[model samples]
Target: MATSGLLNTDILSDEIFDESQARAPAKRCDRHSHKPIDMYCQTHDKVGCSTCMADDHRSCQNTFYIPEFIRNNIYQSVSRKIQTELNKITKTLAEQASKFKQDKQRLLERKAELLADIRRFRQEINDQLDKLEKNSVNEIEDKVKCLESKIDDGLKQIEALEARVTTASNKIAFPNPYQPDVFVNMKMADDAANVANKYMKDTKIKSTVEELDFKHDRTILTQLEQIIALGSLTEDPTKMASSLFRIRGDKSYCVKVKSDTEDCYISSACCLEDGPIILADHNNKKLKQIRGYNYTVTDYYDLPERPWQVCSISKTDVALTLPLQNEVHFISGEEKMKRTNKIKTDFECYGLAYTNNNLYISDASTSVYVYTLSGTKLQHFSETQSGQKLFSNIHSIAVSKDGTRIYVADFYNGLIVLDNNGQVITTSNGKQFCGAKCCYITKAGSVLVSTYGSSVLQFTPDGELIGEVIKADSEGRSESLSVCCNQQMSRMFVCSIDDNIGVYGI
Candidate 1:
C-alpha cells in the first residue's frame, strides 16, 4: 500500500493507481533465510559475500548489505506515495480550470450579442428619425411652393389690369395724330400738321365731330386687394426665405432605477424607472454614485451587524428591524438621521409595514405588534387557540392598500389573514406553495416569493404556485427580493443577493 503526502494535493502517481502483476513470495538464499535480498541484485538488494556478486548474479553490477538497503530505500517509499496523490490533485485542478474557461467564453458571447442588439436598435431609431425629418421638410417645401405659385398668378392678373388702365388713360389724354382736333388747340399744332389740316379743311367744310371730356378714370381693383390681404405675397420675398415653420410641442421623457440590498451577501440587482424608494445600505459604509448618473452614495446609518428585514415608506422615510437588536430604527433622507421613532421590543422583529396612520410589525416571538406612526405602542396580538391548537412565530407582515386587512406569513401556519382589529379571517398551510426568505404581490395580483434555492417562485394570489422567475445556479444563490412599479424608461428593475440586477420591460 502507498502512503499519501502533502504534495498529493498537486498530483498523483500513475504506478500507485494501476497494478498489473500479482505479488509473489520473496526469494532468498537457503542459508541466512531471515535476511532480505533485492529481487534483481541491485544496489538496495542484499549480497552475502563477494562470491555471490561475481558468480550467479554476475550480470547485476550493484549490490548492498541487507541493513544498508533498508536505510537507503525507506525514503523511496515516501517519494512514491507523494507522487501518487499529486497526480490525482493535478487532474482535479485541470477539470476545474477547463470549466472556468468555458464559463468565460460563454459570458463573452452573451456580451457580444447584447452589444449587437443595442447597436441594431439604435440604428433603427436613428434611421426613422432621419426619415421623419426629411419627409417633414419636403412636405413643408411643397406647401410653400404651391402657395407661391398661386401668389404669382394673382400678381400676373393685377399687372394685366394695370396695363388696361394705362391704355385707357392714354387714349383720353392724347388722340391719334391723324384724327382732327378742331377749335381750341389750333395754335399748338405743328407746321406739317397745319399744312395737312389746310388741305383737309377745304375738302370737308362741314364739321360734325364732337370731342369727349377727359374725366378721372376709376377701375375695379378687387383682385389687387384680395392678393394683398391674403398675405400670399411678402413685402420683400428675400427676407421671408430664412424663416422656419412652427410645429406642436414635444412630450416629457423619464428614467427609472430599481435596487435591492442584503447586509450579509449581495447577489443580484435590477433597475426600473420609478418603482420604489431604494436607499443605500449605508450601515456598512457610505453609498456613492457617479456624478451625472442616476445613482449616488449618501450618508450612513448606525446599526448592529444584522438587520434582516427593511422597508422604505417614502422618499424620506425608511424602517429597519433587527433580530439581535430587537428594535426598529427609522431613518430619513440623505442625512440618514434617526427620526423620533425608535420602538424597542423584547422579541425579535422580522418585518415592518406602515399604513397611513399606523405601523405593523412581525416579531416572530409569539405575536405581532401594532404601533402609532410616532412610536406609541397601540397593541400586541398573540396567537389565539383554534380547535385546541395554538399558533406562534408570526414570520412576515403586509398591509392592504386601504388598511382594511393585514396579511401575515407564518412559519408553520403558512399564511394567516387578519382583519384590522386582529381577528383571524383565514389561515392557509403554504408548505409546498411559499418559501422561507421573502415574498410580495405583483400589480397583477400574483405573488412572488424567494426560496432556499437560487430562483424566485411565482404564484397566483389564490396560492397556486406558478413558474419560477429565475432558476437555481451552481455559481450563486439568492436570499433577498425587491420589485419596481414605476420605471424611468419603460423598464423595471429587480434586485437580489445574487450579485446581479435584472431589467425587464412591461
Candidate 2:
C-alpha cells in the first residue's frame, strides 16, 4: 500500500514537472545561485529556491501560494482580461491609422484643385499649400508615433506580466498535491504570480489617439493667384460687391463691327456713367456704341485716322486718340456720338483716359501726356527725378479719384505708379503687371489691369495686388486689349483684341 501511494505521488510529480518545464524552463534561484527557484519575494519581485527564500526573501511582505494562483487565475480569467485590453488598443490604433490615410488623400486632391496655371504666382501658392499639407501630416504622424510608443510600452509590460503569471500558474497548477516538492515550490510561484497580477492590475492602457485636424486659410483659395504672384493676398473681408450688367444675347458678347465686315478689331472699350457701350475699332477706323437694354447698334462714327483708344470724358462725351495723325478727337452726344473737335499734339497719341475732368493720354514716345478739358497740356513727367525715363513703352494711364496718384501700364517697365508729385511708387516693374496692356481705376478704389499673361489684375488704391481672371477659358484667346469699369465700378468690361468682350463683377 505504501509503495503504491509513493508511485502515484511520483507520477503526479512527473506530470507537474513536465507542465512547469513547458511554461518556463527551470530558472536559477537568486540567492542559491545554481539551484532551481522554489520561492517568491513579492516585495522585490524576485523568484528563488529554498536557500534564496531564507537568505533573501524571509523578510518579504505580500507572499503568495503559487498553487492557489494557478488554480484560480492562470489559463483563465486574468490572462483573458489582459488580452482584451490589448485588442482594444489595437482597434483604436487602427482607427487612427485610417484617419491618417484619409487626411493625406484629401490634401493631395485639394492640391490638384489649387494648381490651375503653374505660373510664378500660381506656383508659389501651390508650394505654400504643399508645405502646409506636409507640416500638417507630420504633426499628425508625430502624435501617432507618441501614442504608438505609449501603446508599445504598455503592451511590453503587459506581455511581461502575462508571461510571469503564466509560468508561475503552470508550475503550481500541474504539481502533485501530496508531494513535499510541491509544497516547497508552491511558496515561490504563488508570490511570483501575485506580483505579476499586481503589475497587470496597475498597468493602465489608453486606447485613443491624440487630436488631429487641419485649419486652412479661407481667403487663400479665393486669391491664390495673387498670393502666388505677390507672395501675399490681403483684402477687406467685409467688402461685398456685385454687378448690375444685363446680358445681351450671351453672357460675354461681341460688339457689332460693320456690315458683314469680318474685319472687326477693337482696341479699347469703355462704359459711360450713363451705361452706353463705346468700342474703338482701329481696324475699321470707327467708334461704335451699343444702346442700353436692347443693345442695338447706334452708329459707327468715322475718324480722321484710326481711333486707337477711347475713354469716357463724361456721361455724354468721350475722347479718342489717332496714333498716325498725332491727334486727339473729342466726341460728344449721348445717343449718336460724332467727332465734336480735334486737338493736335506734337507726339503721336495712342492711349486716352479721363479722370477728374482731366484727359490723360499715352503717346508713342512712352510719355504720359495729361491735359485739361480744353486740350491744354498740363505738367507731364518724361523721367523720374533720378533721371530714369518715366516709361520705355506706355500702353494706358489711370488717375486716382482724388487726383493724388497716377497709374500707367508701361509695356516696358510693368505698371508705373506715381504720386501726385510724379514720384515713383512701389508698382513700377511689379511682376503683377509685367504684361499689362490697359488699366483703369474703379469707383471702389481699385486699379484693374489687363495683361498679355491672359489675365486681369486688381490692386487696391494702396497698391495691394489681386489677380481676378475673367475665366480660365479666357487664356490663350485674343490678347486682352483694354479693361474698363462702369459708373459704380462694380461691373467691369474686359475687351479683347477681337470683338468679344467679358463682363465681370468685382
Candidate 3:
C-alpha cells in the first residue's frame, strides 16, 4: 500500500492490468486519503471513498456504494430538490428585476415631465418679453409718426409762403405797370410773413431733434442672473401620522458634554438625517454631536463666539447663528466637525432655520430676515402686511416640512405662524406659551415649543395649543430652553440652561 492509501500500479505487469484502465483518471475523495470516491453516506448526506467512510462517517447509520445509490434513483431525487429551491430563488430575482425596470421607466417619465415644465416656463418668459418689446416699439413708432406729421404740415406752409414772397419781390423789382396786381402781391407777401412768424413762434420745429433711446429694464437681467435654478426636486411626500399623542417624557440623559471653563448650556438642538443630535453649547461657545441610546458626546467643534441657535442643513452639515459676530457659520463632517463656511448678516442673527436653500434668521429683536444660503436677502418680516409688529423678541424659528409655513417662538407674542411669504397666518398667545424659547416642527406638521418657564408646550401646525408635553418641577427651577425630535418623531430631546439633556420617548 502507498502512503496515499492507493495500491501502487507501477510494479503490476502489463498482462495483469488493462493498458487503458491504468492510463485512465478517476475522481478521488477530497479528504486525507486520495482514493477513488466509491461510497455514499445517506445518514450524513455526503459522498466519500471507503477509507473516509470508515474513518469519518463511522457513526453514520445509513451508508451505501455510490454506484448502487445512483442506480436506485437517489441522485435524481436530490437533483429535483436542489432544482426546486433554485427555481424559487430565480423567480424572486426575476420579480425584483421587473420592479427595477418599472422604476426606471417611471423615472424616465418624470424626467420628461420636468423638462417639459422648464420649457413651458421659458416659453412664457419669452412671450412676456415679446409683448413688452411690441409695446415699446409701438410707442416709439407712434411718437415718430406724430413728429413726421407736424413737420409735413410746417413744410407745406413754408412752400406756400415762399411762393407769395417770390411774387411780391418780382413785382417790386420788375416795376409792374398794373398797380392793383403789385398791391395784391405785396398784401399776400405781408400776410405770408405774418403767418410764418406765428407758426415759428407756436411750433417747436427747432427743438424737434428728439433722441429716442431704449433704457432696458436692467432689473430683469439682474433677477435672472440671480436665479440658481428653476426649482428644486423633492422626494415624493409620504403620509406621516402625528406623533404628538404618544409623546411622554419617560427618559432623560445627561448628554455628558462640557467645556474646560463653563458648563454646557444647550441653547439649541437639531437632529441630523441619520440620527445624530447636534447641540449648541452657548456658554461653552461650542457645537457638539451626541449619538446612541446612552447619549454620549461623540464629537464637538469650538466656535469663536457664542452660538445662539443651530439648524441642520444636511446630514453632515449644520448652520449656527453667532449673534455677537453677526454671522451664520456652517460646520460639516461625520466623525469630526469642521468649520466650512459662514454667511455675514446685516443684523444680529439669533433664531435660525433652514429650508429649500433658504435661511430664516431672527434679529432677536422684532424682525425675521430670510436669505439664500449664499447670503442674498430674500424677504424681511418685521411687521405684518397690515403693518402690525410681528414679533417682540424672537428666540427661535422652525419651518414646516413642506417649506410652506414658518413658526416663530416669540417671548412676548407666544407662537406666531406665518406663510412662506412672511404674511401672518395665525397667532397663539397664552400663559403656557408666553415665554416661548424654541420651536420645532415635526414631519407631520405638529409644533413643539419650549418656554422660559419649565414647560414644553405642544401645538398643532396651525398654532392651536394641544397641551404641555413637559412641565416644570415642584420648585419651578428648571426651564426648557430648546426642543427637538428625531426624523420619525420617536424620540424627543429637550435641554434647559444646564449641562444635561432630557430624552423623551414618543
Poorly placed runs, candidate 2 (over 4 Å): 1-250, 260-262, 428-432, 471-476, 487-490
Each candidate: RMSD: 25.1, 47.5, 19.9
TM-score of 1: 0.39
Which pairs clash inside model 2? Answer: 39-188, 40-188, 65-190, 66-190, 121-228, 121-229
* Collision count for each candidate, in order: 37, 6, 0
Model 2 accuracy (lDDT, Cα): 0.67
lDDT of 3 by residue, 346-399 (tens): 888999999988899999879888899999999888877688888898999998
lDDT tens digits, residue span 422-479, model 2 = 8877664666567778877766566777787767776666565654545325544677
TM-score of every candidate relative to the true structure: 0.39, 0.50, 0.52
Arrange candidates, best lDDT first: 3, 2, 1
Candidate 3 segments exceeding 4 Å error: 1-243, 247-249, 256-258, 473-477, 487-489
Pairwise lDDT winner, candidates 2 and 3: 3
Candidate 2 least-lDDT 10 residues: 1-10
Winner on lDDT between 1 and 3 is 3
Indicate the worst ten consecutive residues by lDDT in candidate 3.
1-10
What shift in Å separates residue 91 of candidate 2 from its native position after superposition? Answer: 34
